[model samples]
Target chain A: MSSTILLQSIGFGITTAAVVAIGAMGFTLQLGVTNLLNLSFGNVMTIGAFASLIAEHWHLGLAATIIAAPLAGALVTFVLARTLFALFARRQGGAFDLLMVTLATGLIIQYTIDALAHLQVFQFSFPSGSTLNIGPFVFTVLSLSLVGVAALVLAALLAVLHLTRIGKALRALSVDPKLARACGVPMRRMINLTWIISGALAGLAGLVYVTNSLTVDASAGLDFLVLVIAAAILGGAGSPVGAVVAALVVGIASEVVAAVGGSYYSQAAGLGILALVLVLRPASGVWSGPSRDEVTV
Target chain B: MPDQLLRVTGATAGYRGVPVVREVDIAVGASEIALVVGPNGAGKSTFVKAVIGELPLMSGRIEFNGKDVSGWGEERRAAGGIGYVPQTRDVFPTLSVIDNLEVGGFRLSPKECKQAIAQMFERFPALERLRHRKARQLSGGERKMLAIARALMADPKVLILDEPTAGLAPRIAHEVLEDLVVGLAKLGRGILLIEQRVTLASAVASHVTVLVDGRVSYAARGDEFRAVPDVSALFFGSGEAAERSSWSAARGPA
Candidate 1:
C-alpha cells in the first residue's frame, strides 16, 4: 500500500509540473522581456479562468471558451502595461515602485472578481473522459492532455521567440533599450507585443489549472502563484527551458511531501526551495533585465 | 560642396530642463568632417545628445536634409539616416560582432544585410576573423572598430561619433581617425566627431568648434585653426582670461 501511494504521488507530481511549467514560462518571459515583476500575474490568471467560466455560462462551445480565456488575459494585461505600468515608468520609477504597482493591481483584480463571483467556488465540469492505467500510474484522459497542452504552449512560444524578427527585437530591447532605440527599433510596439504574448500564455495556464482541479474561484490563481513564482525564481530569469526544469523539480518535491504529510507541508517545501534559491543567487534581484542607468535612457 | 545633411541652431538642452549645454550651433554638410573638442565636463556629450534628440531641446530648431526634425525622436533620426556611435557601450557587448552588425541592418533584406556585413569585414579585416566573437571579448580598438562598422551597416548619410577614441592606444586611435573617419568622409557622408585628442583630430577636420562651460568658445575653419600654435590652450582653460591668453596669445583671432 505504501509503494502504491508513492507511485500515485509521482503521477500527481507530473500533473502539477505540467501546470507549473505553463504559468512559469509566461511569468519568466514577461519578467525578462519587460523587466516588470508583475505580482498581479496571479490575478491575471484568475481573470482568465473567470473569462472562460463566463463563456461557458453563456453556453459557448468548448473551443470558444478555451480561446476566450487567453484573449481576456492578453487584453487586460496589455491595457495594464500600456496605462498603469507606463505611468510609473515615465516618472522614473525604480524596481520597487513597479513591484508595488503590480501588487496593488493584483489586489484590485482579485477583489473585483470576488465581488462578481460572490467568493464562492464554482464546479468546473469539463468531461473527464476515461481513466487510463500505465504501469504503476493511473490518470484520467483529461489529466494526460494537460501535459500535452503545456508542451504545445511551450513549443508555440519558443517558435515565436526564435523564429521572428519581432522576437529578435524583443531580446535586444531587454538587453539595452537605448541601443535598441538607436538601432531604429519601434520601442512601444515591441513592448506591447511582449505583454500580449505573456498575457496570452497566462490565460491558457488559468484554463489548464481550472480544468485540472475541477473548480474555479477568485483565489484560485493566487493559490497557484506560489508554485509559479518558485519555479520562475529557481529557473533563473529569462530562460523558458530552465522554468520547465525548475517546475518539474518543485512540482515533484511538493507533491511527494504532500503525500507524506499534508497540503501545508507541500507549500512549505515549495517556499523553502524558493528561499534557498534566493539565498544562493542573491544577484538575481528584481532588476535582472536593466540597470538604473540604462532604464532612464 | 554637397548639401548640409544636419543643422543645429540655438540648441538649448539639458537634463530635466536645467540646461547643461546652452545655445549650441553646429552644422554638418556632406563630405565635411566637423570636430568638436573640449575638456572633461565641457558638455561635449550634451551637445551630441542634443543633436541626436536623446535629450529634449528647450528652444532650438534642428534640420536634417532640409526638413525640420526638432519634433522627431531619436529612433526616427536614426531611421532617417543619422548613424550614432555613443562613447560607451556603442556595441552590444553580449552579442557577437556579426550579431551587432545584423541588428544595425534590421531594416535590410537578407541579401543586402549579408552584402553589408561582407563590406564591413573587408573594411576592418581584424573584425572579419572575430565575427563570431562576442563584442565584450574584443580588445578596446577592435570593439571601437566593430562599433563603427556596425553603424556603417545602415548606409547612413551622416554619422555622429561621441568620443569614439576616448580610451584607445595612440596608435589605434590614429588608425580610427585616419582610416575610418577620413574614409567615410571621402565617400561623401557628413561626420560629426567628438574627440578629446584635439591635436590628432585637427589634421582631418574640415572645421573645428571649441566648447567650454556649455558654450561654443571658438569656431573656425581647419586652415585658420592650424595657424594657432597652442590649440590645447583653447581647451583646459576655465575662465575668460585663460581662454583669451591661450589660443589668442598663441596667434591672432580668426
Candidate 2:
C-alpha cells in the first residue's frame, strides 16, 4: 500500500476506534461493577440501531431518531438488569454462570430481532456533508462528528467518575459493594444509574456504528461484539480511559492489516491482539481469586 | 447514665436458616464500650453480624437510638447511624485513603463529606501522610486505623467492630484496642467490639459478654468480670454450670 493509502487507512482506523471506545466504555463499566460478563450487550446495540431506524422510518428527523435510540437502549437495559439479571444473581449464581446466562440472553435477543425484521438487512444512511483533510488523514463530516461524539462521551464519563458524589459511590461500590453498603452507599440506586448510563452509551455507539458502516441488521451487533469485548479486555476490563486507548490500537492494527491482507483478516487481527493480551496479562481477563465471586448488583 | 445507643434483646440469628447464635442479650450505652469475647466457634462474630443486620434475626428485637430496627436492611441500619467495620475486606483496597474516607461519608452532603474527611485526616495523622496512596499500600496497622476512621466518617451513634485486631501482632493489637477502640468510646459513641484478645479487651471494656457454643456463657460489668478466677475455664467447660458459678461469684452474697 502507498503511504497516502496507509495514512487514509489509519484515519479510518481512528474513526472505527472512536465507535468501539463508546461501546467498550459502557460494557466495561457494567462488567466491572456488576461482574456480569453481559454477552447480551451487542444485541442491545442492535436494538438501539433498530430503534433509530424505526424512528427515521416514521419520518422523524435525524435529531429525534438519535435521541430516541439511546432512550430505547437505556430503558431496555435497565429493565432487563432489574428483572432477568437480578433474578439470576439472587439465585447465588457465580460469575461464570451469570456469563452463560447473558450469553443465552443475547441469543434470545438476536433471534427476537431476527424474527421481527424477517431476517433482512436494512440500509441506513446519514448525510456526509463534506470531507476534510487533516495532515495526511482524510475524514468526512459525519466521521468527524462521530469522533467528536466519542470525545464528548469520554469527557462526560470522566467528569461523572471523578467530580460527582455518585461517582465516588460508584467507585467504592465497584471496588467493594459490601463495604460500600456498610458505609451507607445505596446499592440499588447506584446500580440503576449504572444501567441507564451504560445503556445510553451502548445506544449511541450503535447509532454511530451504523452511520459509518451504512447498514443495519439483527446480526450487525453480534458481528461487532467480538471487537467490543476485545477492546474492553485489552483495556483491563473496567477502565474507560484504558478502553479508549486499547480500541485505538485494535482499530489501527486491524485496518492496517486489512490494507495489507484483506477485509476478512481484519477481525482476525483484532482477535490476535486479544489473544496476545490474555497470554501476557492473565489476571486482567481471568478471575484468579475468591474475591471475584461477590455480587454487587 | 446516658441513653442506651444500641440494645439487643434476645437476639437469635444464624446462617442458612440454622441458628448460630441463640437468645443473646447485649446493650451499649452512650460513651460505653461493650466487648464480646469468646473462643473459636463461640458465635462472637455471628452475634456481631446479627446486630449489624448482616444475618437475619430468627426471633428478637434490635433497637438503635430507641427505635426497633430488627427488620431494617444493613444499609438502612447503617444510614440510621450504625458504623460497622467487618473482619475482612474492611476497606476498599484500590481506593486512596482520602477516597476511602469519602466513601465512608456517602450519606453526607458534599460540604459535610469534605469536613468529615478533613476531620479523619486530623485524627489519623498516619492516614493523612498516606492520603494519596491506595488502602492496599498501607501497613497492617495503618489499614486497621483507616478502617476505623472510615467507619467513624459517618459520625455514627454506635460503632460495631468485628475482630479489629485479629491478624495483628500482640503489640499492634494492644495499640489498636487501647488507643483506637477505647479512644472512640471516650468520644461518647457506643461501641460494640468483638475481640479474641480477652486480656486486652477486658482491661478496657466497660462491660463484657462471653459466648460459648452459640450462647452467652457470662455477662457482667467490667469490675465483676475482672474478679472471675479463670476465663479459659468459662470458654472450655460446659457453659451453663460454669456460668452459674461465675454468676454467683459475680453477685457475691447480694
Candidate 3:
C-alpha cells in the first residue's frame, strides 16, 4: 500500500481507536473490579445509545444525550450489581461460573431492550451539517465531536483512577479484595461505584459509536464488544492507559487492513492481533480480566 | 479488660462443620506475645482463623478489648484494631510493595495511610528500595516481611500472624522473629504468632500455647517452659522439640 493510503488509514484508525478506548476502559474496569466478564455489558451500551436517541428525539442537545446515555447505563448496571450479581458474589462464583452469570445478565438486558425497541431497527438522528478536512482526511462535525468527547472521557477516567484516594482504594480492591476489606476498604461502596463508572463508559461508547456510524439498533454495541474486549486484554486489565494504547493500535491495524483488503476481514485482523499477543505472552494473554480473588465480597 | 486484650472461651470452629478446631480457650494481653505451636493437622491454624473471624465459630465467645467481637465481621474486627495475616497468600503478589502497604492502609486517612506506609518502609529498608517492585518478584522472606508490614499499617492493637517463618533459611527466619519482636515492642502491639519453630517461638513469645490434636495441651510463659522439658513433650513429641530447639538455638545464636 502507498504511504498516502497508510497515513489516511492511520488517521481513520485513530478516530476508531478513540471510540474503542472508551469502551475498552469501561469493559476492563468492570471486569477488574467485579471479576465478571460481563458479556451483558454490550447490552448496557445499547441501552445508553437508545436513551440518547430518545433524548435527541425530544430535541435535547447532543450534550444532553451524551450525558443521558451513560447515566442510564450506569443506573442499570448498578441495579444489576447490587441486587442480582451481589447474590452470586456471596456464593463465591469462580471465573467460569461468573462468566455464565454475566452472560445470562447480558441476555436478559439485550432481550429486554429488544422488546422495548419493538424488535424493529432504529435509525437515530444525529447532528449533520458540516464536514471538516484536516489535510488529507475528512470527518463530519458529529464524528469530530464524538472523538473529542471520547478523549475527554478517557482522560477523566484515567485521572480519577490514578489521582484520587478513591482510585487507590479501587486499585487495591481490584488486586485483592479480601486484603482490601481487611484494610477497611468499603467493599460495597467501591463495588457500586465501579459498576457506575464502567456502565456509564459503556453507554457513552455506544452513543458515540452510533453517532459515528449514523445508525442505531439493538446489536450496535454487541457488534463492537469483541473489539473492546480485545483492546482490554491487549492492554492489561485495570490499566486504562494501556487499554487506550492497545485500542489505538488495534483500530489503526484493522483499518489499514480494511483499506488494503475487503471489509470482511477487518474484524478478523483485530482478533488475529489479539491471538498473536496472547500467544507471545501466555500468562498475560490468559489473564483476560480479574479473577474472583480481585472482587469484593 | 484488665487481664486481656483478647479472649476466646470454649471455642469450637471448623470448615463446613468438620470441626478442625474444638473446645479451645485462650487469652492474650497487651505487651504480650502468644505463640501457638503444633504439628500439621493439629488445628493451630484453624484456631487462629477462628479467632480472627475468617472461620465461623461453631460455638464460642471471642471477647476483644472488653467487647464480644466474635459476632463481628472480619472487616469490623480489623477496623476495631485486630489484624490477621494468613499463613500464605497474605500479600497481593501482582501489586507493588508500596501499593500493598496502601491497600492495608485503607481504613486510615490519606495522610495517615501515607505516614503508616512510610513508617513501614523505614522499618524495612529493603522493602523501601523495592517499594515499586511487585510482591511476586520478592523472595519468600521478603514477601512475609511485606505481609507483616502491611498488617501493621493500621497500628492494630492485636496482630495475628500464621506461620510467619514457615519456609525460610535459618538466618532469614531468625531475622524475621527478631524483626517481629522489635517491631511489636516499638508499637506495644499485642502479637499472636503461630509457629512450628519452638526455639524461635520461645525466644520471642512471652506466653506460649502448645496445641495438639485440636486442643491446648500446655500454656505457659517462655521462661517457665525453658525451665522444664517434659511439659513441652506432652503436646509435641519429646524428641521433636529437642531437635527443633537445638537447631534454632544453634542457628540463631541469640
Q: How accurate is candidate 2 locally (lDDT)?
A: 0.85
Give lDDT tens digits, candidate 2, residues B1-254: 12888888888988889999887878888888898988999998788888888788999888899898999999999999999999889998877888888889989988999999889888888899999998998888899999999999999999999989989989999999889988899999999988888888889888888889888787888777888888887788777763543532443222
Docking class of 2: high
Supply DockQ values for each candidate. Answer: 0.53, 0.82, 0.55
DockQ, model 2, C-alpha based: 0.82
The DockQ for candidate 1, computed on C-alphas, is 0.53
- Candidate 2: where are CA atoms >4 Å away? A1-6, A285-290, B242-254
Can you write out model 2's per-residue Cα lDDT over A106-193, one digit (the tens) per residue?
8999999999899999988689879899988999999899989989988999898877778878877877787888999998999899
Model 3 chain A weakest lDDT span, ten residues long: A288-297
**Candidate 3 lDDT tens digits, A1-297:** 898888888777877888888899998888777667888788888888899989988888868877988999899888888877778877976667767888888878777778887887878776665988887787667667767886787789878876776887788777777777777778788988999999899888888777776677787777677778888888877888788988998888888888999666668767887888888876673274334554452
- Model 1 stretches with alpha carbons more than 4 Å out: A1-7, A129-140, A285-297, B109-115, B121-133, B223-227, B239-254
For candidate 2, the per-residue lDDT at B236 reads 81
Please give the RMSD of candidate 3 to the true structure.
5.2
Winner on DockQ between 2 and 3 is 2
* Cα-based lDDT at residue B80, candidate 1: 89
